[model samples]
Target: MKDTTIDDISLISIPKIKEVRGNLGVIEGDVIPFEIKRVYYLYDVPSDAQRGGHAHKELYQFLIPLSGSFDIKLHDGINKKTIHLNKPDKGLLLVPGIWREMDNFSSGAVCLVLASQKFNEADYIRDFKTFKSFKR
Candidate 1:
């Protein structure tokens, strides 16, 4: 796998259609850099709770705020950056080998995630030290 940097992360704009009832945002497989194999959403999280303190070996993820706002802290083993996901029409594209942590969730925040791979515990590097060594 290629070493991913902070620059590799991007904000993708999904097509949104405005209507009288409500707005609709569409996301297709080709809209992102990778194919979608799994989909999940996080909701009803406590204000003090955090999520995702690990790095993936090959998985790719696209994250969006389906409801409220939250912040994602990303580290490429050398550089760190924080990205906020607050809009329903925008999504964050995350590549492999990057450590990430999500926090600062607003009330009723719903985080929708599109993943390129299925659930596999072996693909995850939960240790920060192991992730740094893997980047080297």
Candidate 2:
């Protein structure tokens, strides 16, 4: 596995169409680097609850806060970063080999995740100690 640093993380601007009555958000074309193969979302999470405590070996992910806000803590075995996401038109691009933890969600916050790969158990590094010792 490649040792992707926290500096590799980027915020992508999802396209938006402003209208008099309402606005529309689009995520097609090359907005996301990977071809989305799986889509999932987290909703109705408690404010004190936490999620995502693992790293992917070879998967790309784009995270968007569809409603409310939350904080994502990323680690790359050597570096760390904290990103607060709250906008609908903004998305965070996470490459492979980074440890991510999501928490501090506002009430009724919905986190939408677009994945480049399907669910694969072998592609995940669930333990932090193993993540630090296994991959480089």
Best by TM-score: 2
Which portions of model 2 miss their true places by more than 4 Å?
none
Q: For residues 1-136, write the lDDT of model 2, one tens digit per residue.
A: 5668888899999999999988899999999989999999999999999999999999999999999999999999988889999999999999999999999999989999999999999999999999998655
Per-model TM-score versus the true fold: 0.96, 0.97
TM-score of 1: 0.96
Candidate 1 weakest lDDT stretch, 10 residues: 26-35
What RMSD value applies to candidate 2? Answer: 0.8
